[model samples]
Target: MAKYSDEFKLMIVKEYLGGPLGYSLLSRKYGIPDGSIIKKWVNAYKAFGKEGLSKKRSKKVYTVQFKLNVLNFMKQTGASYQETAIEFQMNEPSLIAKWNITFIKEGIEGLKEKTKGRPSMSGKRKPKQSKQEKVISREEQLEHENELLRLENAYLKKLKAFQDNPNAYLEKHKQRWHLNSKKKDLN
Candidate 1:
């Protein structure tokens, strides 16, 4: 629960290594709650010298090659995750355990750590598109053509009226046509 400094841990480990007293006695004498932790520290000190007995670090960034090496060593020596973690001076024991699990499931390639955090959305999104198909019956097409012809007739009549008298078309109709033409120009 509490983090001890590297110097304090090294001193405790040195005391335990120097004396012949058992872990329980040493733990009672040193006021350390768990004797098993001292045993782990001793193992760590033996395997990695002073570095293994140091305080825990943040989530370590281990390379794929390093993970593969650890996995291979574990396989060759048949060492447990905890033992391998202590020997390798990993931040946490579960790190090696998870690596072993990944290695077993996905082989050496699995050891490569994936990028962390949420992925960006820009690359995943696509612009909206229209997919509707138009289908007009023969009768409907003829009716549309007839409507256009009627509109043409109306336009001719209006043109004739406007030629005869400039004010034949209403001011509102002229404004509407000017607005429609401006909209067409924009497109």
Candidate 2:
């Protein structure tokens, strides 16, 4: 959606709190598509007063371990995304939902923070590596090989699990599949 100004959000929230009209009525009056948007505004206003309704100036970066902990907490407690976000003092519940989806699709690797924006440009090109520098050390070669093997093993395990219970796999990830299908349809 539509982005609402902090002033407008505070007005709507105050109207919600002070007036007889409920979420649906206030939403309809303001031309908002969903009453839930107003409900979230009210909840955020209650939790953090005026500050919660304000736009975030900068995106907060979360570590991989912190992301894992958030996911674990939700899984263990069976908390809804909004509840978990509130518990963690996060303004956006959708961020947690995205994290969960990423984790499901690509495992832990997906949770790693990606480099954003355009790559840096340099006017000068770097010198080519010498033959000695280009050659991989035996230990490094073995380590690379081992890592590849580990990735292959994990992939095979997941493949086997999906093969063994395709229905269960589809059931578990039906939402993601549905979203993908919708995108395809749009295309």
Candidate 3:
């Protein structure tokens, strides 16, 4: 882990931004550790000018509401990570990217910064569903399965009939397809 001074980072980032050759060439020419660092620095510079490439301050935890607001704004304007970072006064644009990913994956609840590692099971909680609800759900599932089975049976019977009389089935299907296509054209 190498620490790049603000001046050194600004120099490299400026050089990269000024020229066409990207991080790979910059890394080769300057021997500045990883190419990815240059890429990140370039992105930071593009997103937040001089302030973005500076050494980050002490980590400040953001509230869930703030995160939600940031995401909402991003959604409304169709903003990119860098744009959102600039608008929200964030150092690293990747933070907004992470927030968006978390929101899309686990929803608003995911915006909350939870304790890292295994969650404690010590808190007592009520069961999510009671017996009556469970029974109704089971019944609904069974009904769905029964309906599917009936449809499958019907399909198989029709398929067998078609197989037994291919010419007749084909003629009937051609007529049906023409009728459906004509109806679509009229609509």
Local distance difference test, each candidate: 0.80, 0.92, 0.86
Q: State which candidate has the highest TM-score.
A: 2
Candidate 2 lDDT for residue 129: 83
What is candidate 3's CA lDDT for residue 5? 90
2 or 3: which has the higher TM-score? 2
Give the lDDT of residue 110 in candidate 3.
90
Cα lDDT of model 2 by residue, 48-166, tens digit: 88998997999899999989999999999999988888888888889999999999999999999999899789777788888677888899989989999999999998789899999
As for candidate 2, its clashing pairs are none
List the candidates ranked by TM-score, beginning with the highest. 2, 1, 3
Q: Which stretches of candidate 2 lie over 4 Å from their true place?
A: 123-187
Tell me model 3's lDDT, rounded to 2 decimals.
0.86
Of the two candidates 1 and 3, the one with more favorable lDDT, higher being better, is: 3
Scored against the true structure, residue 33 in model 3 reaches a CA lDDT of 73
